[model samples]
Target: MTTPDKPGLRERKKQRTRTAISDAAIDLFLDRGFAHVSVAEIAHAAEVSKRTLFAYFPTKEDLVVHRMADHEQEAARVVRARPAHTTPLTALRDYFLDGLRRRDPITGLNDHPAVRSLTELIYGTPALIDRMQRFKAGGERALAEALCDTTEASDLTARLAAVQIIGVQWALSADNFQRLVQGETADGRYEGAVRDAEHAFDLLANGLAALT
Candidate 1:
């Protein structure tokens, strides 16, 4: 293979490895529960050494949860790439509304029984909950930095705004997930979530003005 072909092959191989690991981990987690499924078991199921699994996912929780981290980065990117006239809040609102329209899992539109079980497992497990908190904190930090780069808001103001934005998203996601867990279909809450998100962002935009 030429140099370009070499990189393409490497990328494809890495993706295959990642998919294998994630598929194996999810299967084991759903079959036996997240707590009962060890990294060794996941590696064995994927036919990879434990070291290879670790190279893909640093922690067992990551096999299931790091996807959320990727989402946060995408959100930050959207905000950063917004039109010059657009506000950070507006960009975030649009991003979320788009997700809602698509019935994205990040907006808690998931219908899979396994996904619901995983959500419950994460909430019920103290360690997973802690990891989630840290993930949120990291996302907030990245968003704050992005906001600061785009707005004239003071450092504290930008950070506070980022926190408020992320918190609203978190609440909305949790509410949708809880509704799903309670047997409500995505169709049941789809319109409600969009309306609620609009109101939530409106409050943030107006509240910031009031504080100033």
Candidate 2:
């Protein structure tokens, strides 16, 4: 098997610049709210020209939501990379628990002020919500395709698993986000969140059999 080549120094620097721009944009958005901020203001704050900012982010909303892309294909990746003996659900269970421990933002376990503010901004903005829905659709498709690669699963089976897997992830994290938005502290809920995630994943892994 051929290993994928690592990004060159130039590519790494470009990613750093992109992250810097997004961080700057989120900071600005949080300071004054997303609707009040402009592309020019974000570009200026990031110390990049408008053209350069556009090169990195296609739309103003993309600046805040691009981070979603980082984990968007994760479901597919876990399935494809899992040990041959491991089931896809088991692989995802382990990954999700690790994210909980690390306070991964996607897991919605992270409660940094910036994280909360950005989530609130996205939830408040209709445009961003629509964009994210489309983004997640692509992720689901990727997961289905990955599941198809396994001989044990039929297309119907694969699609069902893909949908259920993504559904659990979105549902669990969303509950946490809503709680945080309602004034709950991350540290306060950390233990319960971990237990909730565990229960959610256990359901996925064991299904009705676990209920019996």
Candidate 3:
């Protein structure tokens, strides 16, 4: 058996730089809202040159939303990796339920101060909101492509299904975030969150057929 190689020194250094830049940007954004913070300020805080910052993140919005980059392909990966005989909807539904259990920020069930603050910032700023919508669309497209690969469905059918699934997940996450922001504890809201997820997935699994 071959051991997987670790990231080389160059890769590790680049990752450290990226993390520093991202951390600096988030700190500035949280302290002075997303709209008020400048990319130059973040670059200064991270001790990186403006050119280096631009090379790492093309747009100012990317500085803040880059944390979501890991999750961009998550749905598609789940679809591609599900166990044999498991339907895509079941795989995704179970994945989300597990995320809620772990209080994953993507599920919007995390009430940590940092997570809540970032969520509020993104929801409050128009520019960040627009950027987030683009992220969501990319996620949907990836899931659609995965669906087309794993099933015999037409491209249109796969895309429509992806849209509905991704939309439902977003709506659920938003509702969960709103509850937390309203001062509800994540643990206190756990039961209700689970119920809502189940109900939403159930609708996706069964109710949509009635529309045909």
Candidate 4:
């Protein structure tokens, strides 16, 4: 008998493996905290060999926190892709507002205990925090390049604008995460934070016009 063709089989297999590993890592980290978890345990729980797990997630931390890298890259992409008339601050404001409306986990809408625990784990871990800072720096560099592409500003001006925009976002995200961990509902904080973010962006856009 001829073997049946498996359409989209490779993609599905890769996704399944990735999901299994991520779920297993999250479960273990929530149960025992991040520092105590090992790659072998994550591999075992996911029913994959250590080598297979490494193929999906190069590090134990990657299995638990892969989505963050995608988010930072996407933020820079959105700014770069904004319409010619739209300023970078405007693009970032819209992106963050959309995130708030969707109650995205990155905006701290998560209510699960495990999610909160993982946030605490990330904050408490120095290595993970350092990695996150590096990720943010890379994202800022990408954004600065994009800004430079769209404007005639000097390299220093573009870099400074990118730093200010990213720093504001980082602060806002931390505020929302803290609110979530403190048992505040998303709706309770959404309106106030949105207003604050708008004002913050307005200042960036107009107050910094002379510099730009």
Candidate 5:
């Protein structure tokens, strides 16, 4: 598996370019707000042409919310690749816990100043919020399909499980992000956040296992 820590040369180059663009976009958005910054300005700041920027990011909302895209369909991927003896929810729980340990930004436990700024930018902007919700809806659908494929669950059962699991996770992450954006540090909240995550998954797994 081509994990991020061991990216190929071409992947590394692409990552550098992507990082440059995202860093420039984030600086502009944090300084001027997501709604106030234009795609052209971001492209210029990143030293990329507007067409090239569009090539990487289809829309202005994407420039700001692309960070969310990094793990948009991760649940589905995790469910599909789980060990044979592991339940989907168990795999997801372990995956989330690992992310929390790494302070991964996707887990809402990362303490980077830029992450907090980006969180503020997304929630405060109506367009960005809409885009993010769409991304999450897509994740739910993908996970539902994966659940059905892996467990031979009926469509309705799979969707119900997906909604319950994803909803709890999204809520927990939102709460964590809100706290961080409102002047809390990750270290101060890490223990409580992990506890909350475990509880959320426990609730979700109970409900998931009971699904007919």
Candidate 6:
């Protein structure tokens, strides 16, 4: 996809406010369990009114996962923006590989302490897990729509293909995350992650290429 223009001053100020709120919430959630924290406490820590906090983040869970939600449209954007000669699968594979190379947290190849802590929090909390699932579902729908629009595939085909692709991507990311949690460095896991990603995408191509 084409790069988005920089936000104007007003939008930048809003983003800063949102970031402060999210940071405050994460600090509280990480110090105390997610269940123990309250939205009022977070708003107090961030120095924002409850109404403003709610405006930026509709729910408590959102304050933590808004970072991940930012990326929910990534796959669809890749598919929609791929070169004409490239298959959607190929474009997605390339995009994922680039993420791996950059150690992008979305690829689960990042071992930054903050990312790990947030991941642990998400996995440990039921509400956050549920929210994450909803985000994934939204991502899948967006990708399926992109597949239909870009490939002229039937709705069913696009949906099924999106399911498989998203599932594979999640599996790959989880595996990488698990390895990092087990003490492997991202650099150490890079080769295996790349190998697994390539194999996974090849499997996808075998099954879905004809339809696309």
Native RMSD of candidate 5 (Å): 5.0
**TM-score for each model:** 0.91, 0.84, 0.94, 0.88, 0.87, 0.94
lDDT tens per residue, model 4, 99-209? 888877776655566666777878877767877887789878988888788777689998888898888888887888888777787788888778877887787877557
Find the 10 residues in a row with the least total lDDT in model 5. Answer: 1-10
The count of residue-pair clashes in candidate 6 stands at 0
RMSD of candidate 2 to the true fold?
5.4
lDDT of 5 by residue, 63-171 (tens): 7677767588999999999998888899999998888788888777777876776777787889988998898899999999999898868999999888888888788
Q: How would the candidate models be sorted by TM-score, starting from the highest? A: 6, 3, 1, 4, 5, 2
Question: Per-residue CA lDDT of candidate 1, range 90-117, in tens?
Answer: 8888989999888877778777776677
TM-score of 4: 0.88
Backbone clashes, candidate 5: 0
Maximum-TM-score candidate? 6
RMSD of each: 2.3, 5.4, 4.1, 2.3, 5.0, 5.0
Question: Per-residue CA lDDT of candidate 6, range 41-92, in tens?
Answer: 9999999999999999999989988988768988999999999889899999
- The candidates, ranked best first by lDDT, are 6, 3, 5, 2, 1, 4
- Model 5's alpha-carbon lDDT is 0.84
Error of 6 at 183 (Å): 1.2
Q: After superposing candidate 1, which stretches have Cα over 4 Å from the reference?
A: 1-5, 210-212
Q: What 10-residue stretch in candidate 3 is worst by lDDT?
A: 203-212
At residue 66, what lDDT does model 4 achieve? 80
lDDT of predicted model 1: 0.83
**Residue 82 lDDT (model 4):** 88
Worst 10 residues of 2 by lDDT: 203-212
Which one is best on lDDT?
6
lDDT of each: 0.83, 0.83, 0.90, 0.79, 0.84, 0.92
